[model samples]
Target: MPSGPSFLKKFTSLILSFGPGIFAIGYTIGTGSVTSMIVAGSTHGMQLLWVLLLSCLFSGILIYVYGNYTLLTGETALFAFKRHLKWGRVMAILIIIGIAIGQWNSLMGIMGISSNIIYEIFAIYFPGISSFKYEAVITIALVLTAVFYALLLVGRYTFFEKILVVFVTIMGVSFLISLFMVYPLPEDVIKGLVPSIPQVKGGRMLVAAFVGTTMAAATFLSRPLFVKGKGWTINNLKEQKKDAIVAAILVFVISGAIMAVATGALFYEGKPVTQVLDMVNTLEPVAGKFALTLFFFGTLSAGLSSIFPILLIVPILIADYQSGQLDTNSKQFKRITAFACLFALIVPIFGSNPVEMQILSQIFNVFVLPLVILGILLLINKKSIVQVHKTHFLLNIGLGLALLFACIISYNGVKALIDYF
Candidate 1:
């Protein structure tokens, strides 16, 4: 048997090996997933939990595939697309544009919601703030944005991963505890595990949002980048698969816990949750102050965790597009990150409807899914690029089914947007 110190070293190495997956968990399970899951459970009950499971499973497969492709080719997703296939450059540009728009919208929404939650917490303690004001909320959001930017700008990739692991852990634990407090009915929860759609209005849209957020384009785009950033190679394929599994499981647990809490505390009582903050009021009456506070902290952590990756994505995408190394210290990288973070402020500062913006961002993400899936399919099958690492028969089938799933969700997402407009 190993000595205590040796055991500790091994444990530390194992945890460190999980960096890419931990980063993925942090990137996902953010405001978008939290909001979507809560809305689904609060309004539609546990009927949509199966969608979350399906999405996470699909996302896991894609994450592994992307990471494996990067390891084999030493190319990030964008560079692979741009340099490998026909019309690859055009596809890369479209992906960059689509992801940029979706991420920017999400960043604004996350900041807005996080600020409101913080302000509400402050009001509870002080009992002196008479009314909530937009200006005050915006100011809080700017501060949060500044803090997020500083953390990303000053930290190296490992620092970023370590911080995110901490945030994701806090958020995951908080939500898990909150879920236990609710104690959802076993049968209802089990029913959610069985695949069946609810007959509620906007049910399809909710399904789309759940899938979109869980299997987001940004998640896939960032997976290879994380793999490459961690200096993973073809020899790390097994580790990459393990990491993907960990991330997928984390996504399901965190998302499922939030949904269960919402279902048991709100849906069982027939309460409607139209906005993210609406849960604060509803959860308090159902699960008490402690649960409410825990939920808020979880959401705040999620928002911060999400914003870190959202800010890095644009810079990373630009680097991939230019076939350049991702140098965090580079002036271009810092400038791009800053500009993206600052530009997102426009929504929270000037827009009157942040909840709508958040929902729209998720819906827009679905529209981008089919294109990304198609690109991944095309790139992974290219014999010249993937070579011996080319996808096998079963893997291709899985990718095909995932592509089909993306197409169906994309169609529903578009229909929902049109109906709303």
Candidate 2:
């Protein structure tokens, strides 16, 4: 073992090497994290806080499992699926479709919510700036879209990873600062740690919704793809572990802080938070209107930063299903990116209910959760790839539990949708 100073020097370099997973965590903690946590804080007032805690633990385990496999095998999860079990290719395709639907809903919803937040910020700041609201949103979106394409053109993983890390750090600090300013009660916060149901009639559904949002199907599917993009290998095992742990902790902090802020401002006041804008507005009385503006900017950054990688992941996933691996330079990758962007542009134009759309898309996305997880687990644990590093029995059992929980959620989700229809 190295001495303390030497270890610190090496550790710093290892941390720098672990970028893609950090960005993948950013993608996971975007709209889903914001919307669901906002809903939980307003509706249940931290009573369902255990959902985030439990989901974070489970999500960490899943990310570690997926990231470890990619690091060991040097192949993305989709390719592993095709190579190990040819018949399981359909499940891989389903994972991509599920991811595409989820990403489509999230990308559009984030844009809409962030746009609303910006509009509110201008109104609060300038107070008379009515005309620029729409233009401002369009301008911001175009700027972000252009930056995304520019990064894609460069085609270097390091550049994309650095941009994502910078954005993630900024967004994370902004929210943490907001939470500190709010100064929530420690006793009530502690009470949130207990796993109790809320008092409302529809509280259980909200609890499940909270769980669904945190343990998002798309977030799960995207982990391996993101790891592959980083070009990790067996030589980087230490780096992979560090990256997974850091990424998971970062996600938990940002998501949990958002919940804390919402609960601090709205929960005790008996206010409702049905939309992201509502959460932003609720912050004004407690943290001042300018704080709300800051929150909006932070939220906007969080949402906008995630759109590119999510788009990038989809086409690569689709391409991997057709071929055993993804060629970033291939026509399929470009076409899929275009298709994803088209969906992003069109999804919100229909003017559907954002919450309802989130619920529907998540429901459809959850259907393939079992298949996707199973295939990934199987491929990763295979002798050819894993060799002596096969998955442990305990890990397999835990994965089984995750799959079971996902299936139960999917069943309830489908039943709810069917009854509604």
After superposition, the stretches of candidate 1 with alpha carbons farther than 4 Å from their true spots are: 1-17
| Candidate 2 error regions (>4 Å) | 1-17, 125-128, 131-143, 196-205, 324-326, 347-363, 419-421
Candidates in order have lDDT scores of 0.82, 0.67
- Predicted model with the maximum TM-score: 1
Compute each candidate's TM-score over C-alphas. 0.93, 0.86
Candidate 1 residue pairs in backbone clash: none
CA displacement after TM-score superposition, residue 110 of candidate 1 (Å): 0.4
Candidate 1 per-residue lDDT over residues 1-421, each given as its tens digit: 6599899799667666676888778777888788887888888888887888889888888888888888888888888788877888898898889888888888888777777777787777876663656666778888887888888778488888888877887898899999889957888888888987666677767777788788888888888878877887888888888888888988998999999988989999998788756877788998998998898899889888888888888888888788735557678888888898787687668844656677778887887788788898898887887777658888788889999999988888888777777
RMSD over all Cα atoms, model 2: 4.3
